[model samples]
Target: MAGTAGSGSSPLSAGGDGDDSLYPIAVLIDELRNEDVQLRLNSIKKLSTIALALGVERTRTELLPFLTDTIYDEDEVLLALAEQLGNFTGLVGGPDFAHCLLDSVRLLAVEACVSIAQLLSQDDVEVLVMPTLRQAAEDKSWRVRYMVADKFSELQKAVGPKITLNDLIPAFQNLLKDCEAEVRAAAAHKVKELCENLPSEDRETIIMNQILPYIKELVSDTNQHVKTALASVIMGLSTILGKENTIEHLLPLFLAQLKDECPEVRLNIISNLDCVNEVIGIRQLSQSLLPAIVELAEDAKWRVRLAIIEYMPLLAGQLGMEFFDEKLNSLCMAWLVDHVYAIREAATNNLMKLVQKFGTEWAQNTIVPKVLVMANDPNYLHRMTTLFCINALSEACGREITTKQMLPIVLKMAGDQVANVRFNVAKSLQKIGPLLDTDALQGEVKLVLQKLGQDEDMDVKYFAQEAISVLALA
Candidate 1:
């Protein structure tokens, strides 16, 4: 009954004879009532084609009601409608078409909202679409509210600048403070893109008025995920707000984030330090950022400490040699004795990055001495850390230092009581051996390999034999 022709003459049948015969809108309309889903879908497809052929007036009079009737149908039917709805824009006009489609926004279906946001023109959006969006932005369903926040840009473009400033901004602000964390995150995530497109004066005005006030509350969001989303956008805000403004306003928020209870939020801030550095420069980072880095280096979560290790080179590169000599040097060395082996391993692995940055001369004078002290450390893990450092730094520190100074440490560790230390010694020798220049140094390496090859531990023996074969090939 829904798709049936009314008592009066059918407007759909008035098309050219050849077109009507080929499509037969009446038959397609009848097919819509068929129990078979595929048949109903085919009818919808054919109806879309007929709607296009019917021109604007006929499409409005004849086709739109049938499509609108199926608006509450199955998802596949709704998707098909959403796809074809844009085709009728010229016939019904943008505003009228948008209004017709959005009549069902409160139905809690995402397809209609997504389709309308994507398809409507700039003019239509300002008029009919913006009102629908503003209403949908506060839909009782959080998911429906998410759809509005997610598609804010598309809707923003529809309304254009004038309505965006007055109407859409208020809508976005409400969504930002939405009771749902997801809705709040969705709004926060779009803040950067919103500011990036505006003029400098407008960007400043929005930040000073709209953004800065909300930021402290956002950073302190009870949801860790919401805090993370805000963390990701801080640099963009800092860049837009400029150095002085960022320090005055944004930096306090960043400092507070470093003290957040969630390690992830703290980790997010550390990971984006380079972005922060881009705004505030190394001088500010040295003062504001260094203490946070030092605190995080000893974070209770090993994963958090591992993240700090991963970011060591970034901090070192930004802080420069003076900071490295004064602060980072001691911090990196302390990682050798970290309670977690994985943290120690990462610290050892990352040491070459520091060596490469500061150069071999500085390394030989500064880092190498400390590493040598760790090699003979009472704790076997520190010795293992030393072996890992030697393997990592071999090529970078070059043959002269690796063979003369570093090799003796490897040789001593080869006879270490711990199988882990001995295995790593074989591992370090394999990396360090090929860098040796003189026959005497090669012979000394071979002697250590021979001693390790006979070790009681099978893993050490396996690694030593493997090292022997690798060095022979070299």
Candidate 2:
């Protein structure tokens, strides 16, 4: 186990004498037999370094057999071998050697194939790796096919154009149509990157013709997670496919995804609407996309509504004034009174985003009146929503508008019988207090805060005390 096997002058001769050369080899061979798993793994890592140091001829003759023999070892040992085996690809004699190492471990372990694919060159990939990976694509183990699918880009880059079209395309088709949903999902995820890396001519002719159909099938994949993965990369496909082709070929698939049973698929499409809008154009999106978004804004699941609320500013920014005013404004107002406290809080907090995007005049003329009505609503939650909006909007709406117009509603809310309403009033004062210019307005804010500080609810009093401290610091 410890003997050196090479015939030519050893590369180790550059560093030291015979014993020094054999010492590392002896230690690694002995450690490989060590019962401790970690010791064996560490020995494998050191073996890679030694193989590189030994150069191609010595590694092929002296190191490869010991490395290859470990393929039948326990799972942990095989994983370690898989991770380190790539380091020897350059040191091996040729593709034949790389193939033997990879082919032996691949069926037994997934990481081995992945590492070999990543480490080998374009020529070796086509000659040696392709056959093994193609076999892996049809392997009963979904995980084995998943490893092949995950390495699709690395394999394609290795083989380049000629082999990719002839060999890899068929392999990819098989992977995309694999019986395992996970394998198909993994293959679908790489389709965008694969198309992007190819020349435009090839992307259109080979990828669009061969790969795009599989991608479209994945959008309707029975597995929700698979569809979600497809949703994540759909926008990238739109860019590669170009606008007309995206609309004609891919857009129907994208639009159909909006109705996907999976909330994540729907949410992902909404989140990426800006990117989709760029390719599809805002006006074009208005017909189908906007209605779908608006429908999701009122989705039965609050999480869906929450996602739309989170994305409201981007929607407003992208849709611009006319569209925001017509569609999104009412949605924001509805969220303000949403049955869920968290949704209402988020809608209230995002008020300033609308103000920031649309300007102070828009806030003064359009938004303030609606907020004033909410402040006086019979529902204490609506009144609480108003206080939160005032707190967030004061800085954006400026000192004059806040002190004159918004401060009175906050003052009224300070005396609200609902502790939550009064607590929000106290918090709102902290933001508005600093904006008061005149002594009269400043004293009014101070009086309201002091009243709240003495209120019965401890949470309300605590917030009032915090608000007073904030104003004092200002």
Name the runs in model 2 displaced over 4 angstroms: 1-24, 30-39, 49-56, 73-76, 89-125
- TM-score, candidate number 2: 0.86
RMSD of 2: 4.7
Tens digit per residue, CA lDDT, model 2, 1-474: 222323223334333455565667666666666667787778877866777666676677545655554434565666566667655566666545666566435454344555565556677766666676667667776766787788778767766777777877888888888888888888878878878777666678776678888888888888887888888888777777777887788778878888787999988888888877888888887776788888888998998889889999998898898888987798898899999988998898778898999999999988888988887799987887888788888899999899889888888777777999888888887777777875844577788888888988999989989988877832
Candidate 1 per-residue lDDT, tens place, 237-278, comes to: 777778999888888888888888888788778888887788
Best by TM-score: 2
Error of 1 at 360 (Å): 1.4
The TM-score that candidate 1 achieves is: 0.84
Q: Between which residue pairs do clashes occur in model 1?
A: none
Candidate number with greatest lDDT: 2
Give RMSD (Å) of candidate 1 vs. truth: 4.4
Estimated TM-score for each candidate:
0.84, 0.86
Summed backbone clashes in each candidate are 0, 1
